[model samples]
Target: MTTPYLLILLVIGLGAGVSSGIFGIGGGILIVPALMYWAKFSQHAAVGTSLAILLPPVGLAAVTEYYRSGNVDLKVAGIVAAGVLVGGWLGASIANQLNGHTLKLVFGLFVLLMGAYLTASAARAI
Candidate 1:
């Protein structure tokens, strides 16, 4: 890849990595938006690329830190991962059937709701 493209990827990975480690999210939260806006990818392309990163990342950074702090429950996590695998397949199957506009609308609404909930919860704690 070209230097500029590489740099964009580096920034995206950095953002995704930090956000993943901190907030238990990376691809959907950071990478998707970064890919869509900065990389000028279509929403479907962004989603596909973000999904591709899931297995490769292996949750190493966040998992290691959580493991060190004794916050990990490996058995439980493994079980959850299994569920996520199944759910991802199911979700993709459904998502593929939807038109771009409808998919974007639903995805946006979900993000907005989550953002609002998180904001409200944080405010309550402050």
Candidate 2:
């Protein structure tokens, strides 16, 4: 890869990392979209790359801090992780069968709905 290309990746990783750390989100929320748009990756490639990027450094420091602060629940997390392992495989299999445009449309709707739900929940709380 060229230096400029590497730089683009660096920026994407950094942005994704910061937002993930702050929001407790999977970096795929940002990384996959950034890769698809900025790096010119197909939807499947972007999702795969995002998953690869998350395989290591899976928020170790953040988890540690949350655990220290009495915010981590190991059993619940383990159960969720177990589900994710199976679900991720199934989701990836389905995604692979989708065309790029259809995948993007689905992804966009998912994000939009989540954002709306979060905003509404916060408004209710406030």
Candidate 3:
């Protein structure tokens, strides 16, 4: 990779790490999209790479801190993690079979729907 690409990856990694730490969100949410947009990675490649990076304890320290602060829900997190493992595999498999444009469109729609749901839920909570 070129120096510029390396720099981009470093910046993307830092952003993803910080976002994951602060929001307790999987890095895939931001990382995949950023990689697609900034790094010009295909959706499947971005998702696959994100999964590879996340397979390790990338956020273990942050998660442990949250647990120590009594902010981590182990039971819920375990269940969700289990579901994500299954769902992510299925999603990635399907995405790999799709064309890049189709994958981008589907990913965009999914993000839009998720954003809408989060907005509604936040409003309701308020």
Q: Estimate the Cα RMSD of every predicted model relative to the unseen true structure.
A: 1.4, 1.3, 2.1
Computed on alpha carbons, the lDDT of every model, listed in order, comes to: 0.87, 0.88, 0.83
Clash number for every model?
A: 0, 0, 0
Regions more than 4 Å wrong, model 2: none
Candidate number with greatest lDDT: 2
| Model 2 lDDT per residue over 61-126, tens place | 667777899998999999999999999999999999999999999999999999999999999998
Model 1: residue 55 alpha-carbon error in angstroms = 1.4
**Tens-place lDDT digits, model 3, residues 31-56:** 89888889998888898888887777
Off by over 4 Å in 1: none
lDDT of 1 by residue, 17-125 (tens): 8888887888887898888889888778888889998667757767888899999999999999999989999998988888877877888898999999999999999
lDDT of 1: 0.87
Model 3 pairs in collision: none
Instruction: Please provide the root mean square deviation of candidate 2 (C-alpha atoms, Å).
Output: 1.3
TM-score of the candidate numbered 2?
0.93
32 in model 2: Cα distance from truth in Å? 0.4
